[model samples]
Target: MQKPLTDFPTGSVVRIAGIDGGRQARSRMLAMGMTPGCPVTVLAGGPTGCRVRVRGSEVVLCCGLAGKIMAVADDSDEGPRCNCCPGPRARAI
Candidate 1:
């Protein structure tokens, strides 16, 4: 099942299921490559915001902004893996 991006734990590898927001917000995220089906790893988060690695790049988003992005948790033991990078960087969420 899909849940708000914030619902997932840090280091979880999740696939973007969908997004919720107005045109501008959605466009911004999409343009930044946070589109549906993309795999993102939650790096760190707090009450207000979090940092995520998207498409091998790290990006930060506020809780409100993150709430708009929905994701399906992946079953892989390791966290998100950036194909562009090397080494076993994945961690348990």
Candidate 2:
């Protein structure tokens, strides 16, 4: 089922469904690799914003930006397993 980005729980892997915002916002998101169909995993969330793991990169997104991203929880077992390497740490805001 589809849901807002803010509703997604931390650590939940999801696929970008669509964006809901004006052209400028969409363009910015696109530049950041948040285009529709992209896979993203919610890492943390809080008052300021949320952090998401996308394509092995950890990106911190503000609530406004996060709100524009629409995604569906990925319940598939066919994707590659994550290799949680020791690198940048992620914490709930």
Candidate 3:
């Protein structure tokens, strides 16, 4: 079984897998450099918004927006990874 975006912890480097909403949603994600295959690091998350680090930029996305984005945990232990490394494997939400 594959891991879902919600499986990642507050700070984990992940790769964008899929977007689960409409065109507008997809477009918004794309605008944030969240297109499939892009890497994103979870900064912080709550009921309100999730702070994500993408392409060296930090952005906050609401829960609704975050729910639309699908991501996979990046298991590669490549150096320092991202500023938001939530440690080992995280369970799904």
Give RMSD to native, each candidate: 5.1, 6.8, 7.4
lDDT ranking of the models:
1, 2, 3
Q: In order, what lDDT does every prediction score? A: 0.73, 0.71, 0.67
* Candidates ranked by TM-score: 1, 2, 3
Global CA lDDT computed for model 2? 0.71
The deviation in Å at residue 27 for candidate 2 is 0.6
Q: Which tens-of-lDDT digit does each residue in 4-75 have in candidate 3?
A: 455567977777777888999889888876666567778886556688888778888877888777776666
Judging by lDDT against the true structure, name the best candidate.
1
Candidate 1 clash figure, as a count = 0
Q: Which lDDT tens digits does candidate 2 get at residues 6-83? A: 888888877777888999989998887676666788889654678987766789989898888877756543322223
Error of 3 at 3 (Å): 5.5
**Top-scoring candidate (TM-score):** 1
lDDT of 3 at 56: 71
Write the number of the candidate with greater lDDT, choosing between 1 and 2.
1
TM-score of each: 0.76, 0.75, 0.71
Model 3, stretches more than 4 Å misplaced? 1-7, 76-93
**Model 1: runs farther than 4 Å from truth?**
76-93
